[model samples]
Target: MASPLIGITTMNALRHDGLAAVSLLRRYVIALTEAGATPVLIPSAMPDDGVDALLTRLDGVLFSGGGDIAPEYFGGAPHPRIGGVDPERDALELALLRRVVEDGVPFLGICRGCQLVNVGFGGTLYTHIADQHPGALKHDYYPDSPRDLLVHEVRLKEGSRLAEIVGVEVFRVNSLHHQGIERLGDGLEAVAYAPDGLVEAVEVPGHPFGMAVQWHPEWLTAHATARALFRAFVEAARGSD
Candidate 1:
């Protein structure tokens, strides 16, 4: 059988030369590829019809980590720390996410992707966790920190699909985001949580494989759990085909 084709979202970015571009980190590609799936980058500028056409061909969709989502979409309050807000990316991702969920396409989200899943489903975010979530741990371990550095423990809910795929009840994960889910989305369940009590993972009940995590598992694929997560997603996508 042919490897499943997975559509991954890209963010709006500026090249060093000051030109506009749609970019995605190669690690996401590497993660999906190593898991035996064909990864395709879906830019934010694609029109509704284009996205619709792409969805029909994709076996799975992966929303990657990037900038903070705009506050307007989810009726969130603005914060000084809010940066990298892309209107186009927000519109594209939310629309794409709703479609994928409605279509029952196997999908996985990471970091900002997790937040997107929340906001896409009428839920809100903390905007800035430190200020909004009292006593929140330092979750933004990026730039200076190694991508694979495990910063905190996330306890998985027993019997959750994530726990089943990871084969463990609790594990350390690399933290790389400032915002987090403040309210659980409709039809979504929190399947894991950080030591600080912030939601760390969520899954859509009744969906074939709808899940999202607040960590960078793609960078931590050296561990069996991370690899297993990606493999399970790819296998789910394969089954869909």
Candidate 2:
């Protein structure tokens, strides 16, 4: 059987010398490839029609983490703490997500990708989670330590698709985002949560294979649960071929 072709979204970035570039963390590619999938980088600025055309050839779609989605996309008022918003990337990914859903392509969204999936499906987010939800754990850990540090534990819902895939009711994950889902999108169900009750994972019921996690499993490849998540995703993608 041919290896599944997984489309991974790239971040729009400018180099120090001011040249434009499409960027994606190597960890994402490594995780997918190691799990038996061919990873393809999808530029964030591709035209809507272009993305639709590309989707025809992909076996799965992976939405990787990056900048925050624009507040306007979710009908929320802009907060002072909201990070840089990439309208082009947001537009492209939102359109791409719709096509993926319509076509029933396997999807795995991580971090910002998780939040975008929620917003793409008409959900709202806490612009600044800590400020809006007092007593919530500090989630933004990008500058403080190594990416592999296990920062907090998320309790998986009993019998959830995530729990089955990871084979655990509770597990530790790295925290590195400031925004979080406030209202889940229609047709989506939260399958994991932190002790403070913030959503940690979600899945779209009735979809072939659609799941999103607030943590970056790509960086946690050594963990059995993390590896299982990727393996399950690749297997689902492979089945689509």
Candidate 3:
């Protein structure tokens, strides 16, 4: 049997040499590789026809963390803190996510990808959690803090797909975003949450393997739960072959 070919979305970024490029963090690749899957980085600027062709060959799609999505897509309020709004990336991901969901393709979303899943399915966001979510916890613990630092605990629903994959009901996760789902997208169910009552994870009710988490599980692969999450995703993708 062949290993699953998982497609990961990349951001439009400038290379160290000041040239334009599509980029994704190495942690995502490392995590997926360890899960027995072949990872492919999908450019944010790929044309519609190219993305359509690529999707046919992919067994699964992983939406990695990145900068904020544009407020216009989700009817979100504007905020000064909303930076790195890539129109092309936003357009690409929104279309890709819906297409994958409709096609019943296995997918796992992280951080910004989580927010995108919500927005793509007729949902809303806090825009800025600290300012919008009353008494929100400090979820933006990145750049200045260690990437793998376990910041807070997230409780999972007992019978949820996410909980079953992680094999736990409660665990600590690293917080690294200032936005959260205010209203879950249609057909999506919240499977995990933070102590502050913020949605931390969600799964599509009937899809083969459609799930997303607010935390960066890739950075926490040292933990058994994180590894299990990726392992389950890869296994699901492998079934698609």
lDDT (Cα) of model 3: 0.93
What would the per-residue lDDT of candidate 3 be over residues 117-151, giving only the tens digit for each residue? 99988999999999999889999998889999999
- For model 1, residues 57-149, the per-residue Cα lDDT tens digits are 999999999999999988888899999999999889998998999899999999999999999888999999999998899999888899999
* Candidate 2 residue spans exceeding 4 A from truth: none
Question: Where does the lowest 10-residue lDDT sum fall in candidate 1?
Answer: 47-56
Task: Please give the CA lDDT of all the candidate structures.
Answer: 0.94, 0.91, 0.93
Between prediction 2 and prediction 3, the one with superior lDDT is 3
Give lDDT: candidate 1, residue 182: 95
Model 1 residue pairs with clashes: none
Runs in model 3 lying further than 4 Å from the true structure: none
